[model samples]
Target: MTNVAKARESAVAAETRVEKTVLKVLDRLHALNARLVALHGEIKAAQPVSSGSVCLELYPCGPGCAGCPHPRWVKYTWTVETPQKPSVLLSINLDAKERDPVLTLARSTPHYEKTAELIREAKSILLERKKILASIRSLRNSARL
Candidate 1:
């Protein structure tokens, strides 16, 4: 019932709350790190080809072609190497809408790119979470003083 006793009780409660919050943050960071590892493995397994890089290029109709039906066209090029054979360059233009063998890659390529983007976003979030946890720890330290 004394003033000093009440202040001590309140401080203890606040410390407990901060500790719980820190535990929650640590749990989330652990989960995120696991997800990051799994995503990396999936991306590696989903490699489009043994060895190749996908490229996207955009070409404008032209400076004078103001009324061109197709102002711009998208092209995807894949350079792959086959066993016991020279490297082959495969190219496809989206404007034509013609189906090509490489069209199959279109699906997987986007999935791969999207997963990569997700990984980047997750990494950024992980860094932010770490910063928040650090700040919380600093706050707790200052409170102890």
Candidate 2:
């Protein structure tokens, strides 16, 4: 084959390879977008009835303090945020109020944790999508197509 024909063949092969790569990148981008939508939906749907943090607090007393039998108690504080009301702090003492329903529900439910995990996953996926797009742009510029 002549030199000109050989160069044409090489260019056609490079173009074909670039086209294949672009298609694969597009497919990945579509999948990532679908996953992001699902994650956002689930995160939005999750509405915690009540959520709080529990901690054990020790009183300022000596080892032999006759004032109180127990110096340490579990303190439960909940922060509730909603469209109607935001940042409503609810305090519950498990040591004193053992029958508190909010603490009980919060202990048994993992809504907050799951929502946080979903959000993190969504963020990583978004970053990945952005990187993929940047790479695709570079590929196009390099290929001059």
lDDT per residue for candidate 2 within 1-64, as digits (tens), equals 9999999999999999988987898788878867765654565565343344433333445674
Where model 1 places Cα greater than 4 Å from the true spot, the runs are 52-145
CA deviation > 4 Å runs, candidate 2: 49-109, 136-145
Give lDDT tens digits, candidate 1, residues 20-67. 987887687666556655644554454454333322222346675322
Q: Which run of 10 residues does model 2 get worst, by summed lDDT?
A: 65-74
Candidate with maximal lDDT: 2
Instruction: Give the least accurate 10-residue stretch of model 1, judged by summed lDDT.
Output: 65-74
